[model samples]
Target: MPLSRVVNDPEALTITVVADFPVPVERLWNAYADPRQLERFWGPPEYPAKFTRHDLFPGGRSHYVMTGPEGDKAPGFWEVLAVDPGKSFEVRDGFADEAGVENTAMPSMRMVFTFEATEGGSRVTTVTHFGSTEQLEQLLAMGMDEGMRSAIGQIDDVLADLASFAAERATEAHILSDSQVRVTRVVRGSVEQVWRAHHDADLMKRWLLGPDGWTMTVCEIATKVGDTYRYCWEPEGEGEGFGFDGVLLESVPPRRAVTTEHMTGTDYPSTTNQMTLTPVDGGTLLSIVITYPSAEVRDMVLATGMTDGMETSYARLERDVLVGS
Candidate 1:
């Protein structure tokens, strides 16, 4: 006999299960959409199976087979009714025979999977709808709820593993204008050494932004008032790079330098970066003041933990130059 439904009323027995997993939305969606990933955890222990001909888009079809205790195989088919990548998907379920044809034992069911992004990860809800009350009750009698609970448990394990993997791939996306981080550090190095690290092409490459492939086609700095320079930053690879076109507002070689970093590809407003290097008792006190266009930008920067990113970058610089030198 086919598996019985868990609900009795078509309207009253809508079984909805919501589960939270510590995996990013993209990772969670990929686990369901990708066949290789789906094969790892979509079945119960009693009937281990793999999806066949699985397709994730609307109007697509996926087939699967389950092996019973005596090695008997039961096949099934799912026709995707709607797909919203990384968000939701809906499908109709049917039984299939050994010959890979649809069977008449069970009525078709509408199954919907929805994903909602949470603070740390995502919440996934699966809702299954039966055609009639009798079908729902029939499924429940067959322990369908327990089977679903098992299936969802497998999903939880898969998502936990994926959370670790997704953490490494997280990069902040350019969204609002007011999100930029300002970081300050005190360096136990001479002002000249610190200034050189910021201005010298070789030193800049070693510590700051790039191996950006652009030949520095033009890096001319006046170090003094009334002199301006422009660097035609170009991307090294096939695509166009984020280019900055601005004048040096102030430059005092070993003491202070300020520039407007205006990049074409970034949504961030042009930033005025004023870096001051002062010779203290033993070393140099480096003060960096980054002024954004507005408070919103400042909040954005704080929200993304850009401060932490800056501290990390600066720590790397300290190790590479202060300690290594």
Candidate 2:
């Protein structure tokens, strides 16, 4: 038997695999939606696979981290575009770095998997649509087709097992509290790269968002303790967008740096933010710890979608500082 393409068009390329299994549509759908069920059959059978986080909802996404035979781990994110319980689901897939940051990829595709009930059992057909033929060819040359085929086979096996169990697990809601959402990834890249991205006024503007009329007036790094730095953002009219200042508590060249970030817009005075960098395998682990005055203040900041903001910031850092440099 030879692999065949299902839909071949200028705008989309889809591959469908039809397998008749001795299971119902609901059981198979559970294997696709549930994180635990997905982990069982979501990757290369030879490789130990796991799903880090799987959130199936609009504006929600799932992250799967796969470790290869060489111990190198690669992360992938699937943004849930649509979900119809037990019938069909769609998602946008992309690659990310270790810090759970998405990369720059043009014309991302939609992967839709549908389940239908037949006389014998259930039929699963997965259709992936790329924006262009070049995109489809590029993905195929990258071995995406084979990888997905293996992954779906794993899903098939897991669903067969689930059918024997006769009990479907409930989906868990992915929710985070303000105080519980801590800054997770702190990566240490080359000092020149890091400095160029973080300290440079022009480059900072590309990643960090500011008010309507905001500019970086003062940015000084002494590379030592007791050094003070201030970033002043000017607003258009009568609005608070100034006096964002910090003090360098510790600084070591290309190794570590600690600073205190203060926001004048907040009701409270400020908070203590510490950043540390330690040398690791061919790189460094940069850890950031922000201590708030109270739990209430922390919750308020989290409620403002700061976690998502930081995730996007780190993604920019990876692209500009790590990849571009």
Candidate 3:
């Protein structure tokens, strides 16, 4: 119902859909920039989406799976091509296998999403360019048009619910899949400051402490890919100490980072952590997606009140490090 028009042009080999919303351009733009909001309406009603990774910057990639009523899943990915914040972005959209690798046999398309201020409120136009007429026709026959309309119809509800994703909210964890969990928080700091807080040894020792009475005894910062970082924590008076060491897998500066984390002195399997930061209305949105070795491991970690501890640390970060700086 939000769609004003849907055009399939054979000569141009493009499918364009225009939709209008009764919200400001920023509100509409945030829905896509933030993965939590994006997953809510990225898929049709029958196939709800779960975004495991969503990086809105150029050269970044997003991976999501749409689960059907019968528990079947269809995975897809997007390679971000360009971005003009609050205005437009282009991506190479394609189908993917269970591993999130693109299926070359299937056709992929270039998609351009444009957002603009309208007389009423705002408008969004999506132009999907196919490689050939055959590919476009193939996609249309696969219910692409109806699927898009169904997906956009759910955006109204998502936009109306502002409190759910508010910046003041505490840290929360979402189960992205059997082996993946996404933890999110909006800290009262710029993206650069938040990124630095995680990297600078002194800055980290000040706020990365959870709860109280615990001191970070060791903080070895990882400055580049392939570098290994270690962090150890000990109680002020008495308790068993703990530590974690990880190798930096990827680093994109103030925007994103990926690392392999392992508990020190433990033989347990390692976990891959992917963190992304985006500037939102109130502050910077920090999203970390952790891929565990198994569902049991993921559940066990979450059952240990991981999010609660994370919330405590984030609060300390804002109160101690970012408030004035």
Which candidate has the top score in TM-score? 3
lDDT of each: 0.62, 0.59, 0.94
Model 2 agreement with the true structure over 40-145: per-residue lDDT tens digits: 7667765545554455545556666677788777677888898775688889987776445787664467888888887766777777777677888887787776
Residue 145 deviation, candidate 3, in Å? 0.8
Error of 1 at 91 (Å): 0.1
Q: Highest lDDT among the candidates is held by which one?
A: 3
Which order, best to worst by TM-score? Answer: 3, 2, 1
| Model 2 regions lying over 4 Å from their true place | 1-11, 105-107, 163-325
lDDT value, residue 61 of candidate 2: 63
lDDT score of residue 314 within candidate 2:
60
Q: Write the per-residue lDDT of candidate 3 for residues 23-139, one digit (tens) a residue.
A: 999999999999999999998999999999899999999999999999999999999999999999999999998667999999999999999999999999999999998999999
Q: Model 3: how far is 93 from its true place, Å?
A: 0.3
The lDDT of model 3 is 0.94
Candidate 1 C-alpha lDDT tens digits along 1-325: 1122333335665887777777677767767764434655666778765554455656666777777699888688888899886799999987897434778877667899998888867777888898788878887787777777676667666655644323132222222123323244556567677777777765554445344244344455545555554554455667664446456787655665778766645676787765655443335545555667787766765676665554554555566766656
**What overall lDDT, based on C-alpha atoms, would model 2 receive against the true structure?**
0.59
TM-score of each: 0.47, 0.48, 0.98
TM-score: the better of candidates 1 and 3: 3
